[model samples]
Target: MEGAVISDEQVDLLLADTLEQYGYDFTGYSRASLKRRILRLFTLDKALSFAEFRYRINNDSSYFKRFVEQITVNVTEMFRDPMFFKTLREEVLPKLGTYPFIRVWVAGCSTGEEAYSIAIILKELNLLEKSLIYATDINPAVLDRAAQSIFALSYMKQYSENYILSGGTKEFSGYYTANYSLAKFNDDLKKKIIFSTHNLVSDRSFNEFQLILCRNVLIYFDRELQHKVFGLFDDSLEELGYLALGTKETINFSPFLKKYKRLGTEKIWRKIQK
Candidate 1:
């Protein structure tokens, strides 16, 4: 027979107590979802019971990094939800391009897929050299991986399909080369991006952006924290700049509702002209 699972109450104790000790603030996360992820964490680390896991998380940096990875393992792919990129290239980029120079922030850019996706589009639009991309993620481990600009070979097929759907005309293979099991991206495409560790949980707004893409990241945060992040984005976006959220995410329910309009059906929004 298999081992029994941990209880949700125990999982709460694990998360809440660990948060109290580390000051990482999981208190704002959705309780039910957090419990689910913690249960999965326990399953993945079957050698460690909840108590032992909590102990390691509090006392060891290495354990904490692994814990963060478990908690924030989101799915991503290049040109994902291609209509979003279509909306970007059609409705958003034109306005952004009107500026002499552009600054775009890709908040929570996991594993560099989204960042690279954006760079490819900008390159196609001839804005690559004139624009600055700040691709930030809370996980330093993911940041390091993003900096390398290599992706698993298995993902190439899916990325190529997405690129095509998003109006790509070039051979996707032309942008990368195979090295053993990985596909290394072209050096020219990597030059315009800056990958850094930025905690959306604790970090303050550091710069203004003409376009901000914080896709799918808000689903992990509670409503209050989502609004807080929206405020940060609103402040960071310039007059008439663009904002793109995840497929299901939106600014409609928040105070930003009146201050933005959907750029298209594609999850892109522009700041109100006021």
Candidate 2:
């Protein structure tokens, strides 16, 4: 039977229970999106009622993990919105080269595609040796998949196209090897990355960074949470550091709006030097 419609109050209760039991907070996410994802869980499981769904989530830790993964939204591709990476290559990376070393944080780095993209850029610029990339996501499952650096072979065609459009000089296929259904990226590219499970909702900044990319992540958050996260990014970045957001995200409504200066047409922003 199709699951009975889950009410907003029930979803809120689930979010609260998730926070209390798992310590993962989703309180600040957009209500509509949260509702959709939660409803999807019910539909996928053929859950008959909200009570059953809640009971399953509460009793089965593994089920809860899957549920968390479902709601987190791991949609991403390498060099997505190619112009953004193009701008990073042309404008941002050159300026960053002045620094003796570079630290980058790719928050919500699902499946490590974007992090790998950045590492490829650094490699091209001969900066990989002096760079450290911390790629984090709230879902441990995604992190595990990301650390494997093995993506579907089907994606390579699109990724290669993105690479070419993003101003890549070398053959994009050179970076990875295809093994049947999977494509494994070069081990050398993986060396500089550190993958970890990080809860951005409740976590504090652990280190300063010269470049922080949290693209497509803020849109899921409500205004108040977006502001809070912007403040966190502002605190985490070095003066004159770069912040990159998703194509659809903007800094106009942020409390820290004036603190960042947009660079060209790309979603790249720079912290104004004091």
Candidate 3:
């Protein structure tokens, strides 16, 4: 553990070599976030020093996959931020109705919570039939879980309250049925969503979208990465489409600050004409 101190030079060297060799770009991520995750590698595994861990990960595909999952920032909950969903319900959805068909890209959707939340809202608006949701994440494990749309039963009570606070119309129970320890989400809701592997740092844009929801995921990245990904979102979204971020995030500091119209403090921003 003593030799595992991940210095800035080590971080730089590791990240640069990683991108050059594997095309996984951690170089553009926040130094603090990078430090924390790297430190965890040392603390969790007694066999590894900074250089040793880098050497091991460079050769081991399984180790690198674990690193990808660890670094991708998968923390999320169903209707986690009530106001964001409330804003979507009250403001964003109504304006979005003009489009006969809507395609939403939920970038960095973790464990299916946010995607399910959006699906619930679209269902309430009678918009699910016309909607196609592409939910993506760097963590394949989380994406697999998301695809299953089954969550632990223990978390449902909290999520039910969140659903209610986010302006749910029917009994929150109407969305999912309980088995003893798991809640399998509605099959109808599952049909509208397509969950896949997407690396915001390395992957190229797949399609232009009517809305892009990239929330707390960016908080783990440095400003350069943030701006680069923002540009990606800018290119991916259709003209005047919406970009919904996490409650603490904003485009004000990014290059797209002027390119987007901030709908409100609820973290909904409308991408306008560039």
Candidate 4:
């Protein structure tokens, strides 16, 4: 309904039903952000009230998948916040070189662009051979797209610009070949990356990592959930390992605040030695 006033109780009921029926947890997400997304979903059909939408969510298995997709934000890009990548190249990668092998975890990697960007940087720095990247997200749809490694050809211009700004030494086009409407990234880059589905809200850390990039994904979460995920990251990182967050996120208020030391001006943090 165009003018339907969905109550807070309705949203809570919907989230609770989603968790109970589908086992997907959205209870820890920021209320306002979740509300906006849910309203946006409701606007997709003006005929359905919030209760009807909630019923559809509980009744239709297929629509449940779409509902999950709707609420989860997938906005991301290659070398997003170019300067952050630049710092990663200049400051972080060099330190990681001391390790014989490196493991990088890109959490909530939507549509694969972030993973591809990291692979490219590692390749440029001659570290790809020794690196294993685990790129994960909760959305199966985006994970498939990421595994395909084919982005819209139109996005190349912006991705290329981001690449250059992120200290790309060679022509950005060298990394991918363009078909008529899609740009296929090099298979070599994809080989070093593993794409999987990981639900940050409910899943535990699978492996220790030398670097964890959970960029831009935490902003959707409220403080309690943010701390939970931060704890997961704390456990996931090896001693002196790096943790990168979104530009707007910080470890300041986190319980693990003292466990990490901020690095330079980037949103990067280094795990403090015990």
Which model is ahead, 1 or 3, in terms of lDDT? 3
What do the candidate models score in CA lDDT, each in turn? 0.85, 0.92, 0.86, 0.91
TM-score, model 4 to reference: 0.97
**How many pairs of residues collide in model 1?**
0
Arrange candidates, best lDDT first. Answer: 2, 4, 3, 1
- Steric clashes per prediction: 0, 0, 1, 0
lDDT of 4 by residue, 1-274 (tens): 5566777898999988988997889999989989988888888766356667888899998888788788899999899999999999999988998899999999999898999999999998899999999999998888998999899999999999999998887999998999999899999999999999999999999999999999889999999999999999999999999999999999999989888899999999999874
lDDT of 3 by residue, 94-206 (tens): 78878999899999998989999999999999999999999998788889889998999999899999998999868888888899999999999999999998889888889
**How many backbone clashes are present in model 2?**
0
| Distance from true location, Cα of 176 in model 2, Å | 0.6
Which ranges of candidate 4 are over 4 A from the true structure? none
Question: Which candidate has the top score in TM-score?
Answer: 2
TM-score of 2: 0.97
How well does each candidate superpose onto the true structure, as a TM-score? 0.93, 0.97, 0.94, 0.97
- Flag regions of model 2 displaced more than 4 Å: none
User: Could you tell me the TM-score of candidate 1?
Assistant: 0.93
* TM-score comparison, 2 vs 4, better candidate: 2
174 Cα displacement, candidate 3 (Å)? 2.1
